[model samples]
Target: MRRLLLFLLFMVTTGAIAVFSVQNATAVSLRFLAWQSIQLPLGVLLVLVAVLALWIPYIASAGR
Candidate 1:
């Protein structure tokens, strides 16, 4: 039952991302302090950030 719930949650999150990407298909740029980034699709940028956010915590805990 727990595995099934997790699977459903994963499916919902993926579907949300897909819908968000399709609706927000626009070019965007990032700037922080003196640094700047090249233009990328908004959805791509968001997905990258999401992946990094999830990965960073996993990596940190694994090192301990």
Candidate 2:
């Protein structure tokens, strides 16, 4: 029963994230340096940043 509740919670949270990502995807752009730019969905950028952040901590700690 507890596991089922947790699973439902996870599903709801993920669904919310998906909906938010889809909505924001169309309204984002990136600017780098002067006179350089590219357009991308916010969700893609966020996922890339998240992956980098998660990996950095693990990589840094691995050497210790």
Strongest candidate by lDDT: 1
lDDT of 1 at 54: 88
Question: Which candidate gets the maximum TM-score versus the true structure?
Answer: 1
Candidate 1 Cα errors over 4 Å, as ranges: none
Off by over 4 Å in 2: 1-14, 27-37
Query: Using Cα atoms with residue i matched to residue i, what is each candidate's TM-score against the true structure?
Result: 0.87, 0.55
Candidate 1, which ten residues in sequence have the lowest lDDT sum?
41-50
- Model 2: residue 58 alpha-carbon error in angstroms: 0.2
TM-score of 2: 0.55
Residue-wise C-alpha lDDT for candidate 2, range 1-64, written one tens digit per residue: 9999999987996687678778886746666666644676777777666679779999999989
Local error of candidate 1 at 15, Å?
0.5
Model 2 lowest lDDT segment of ten: 28-37
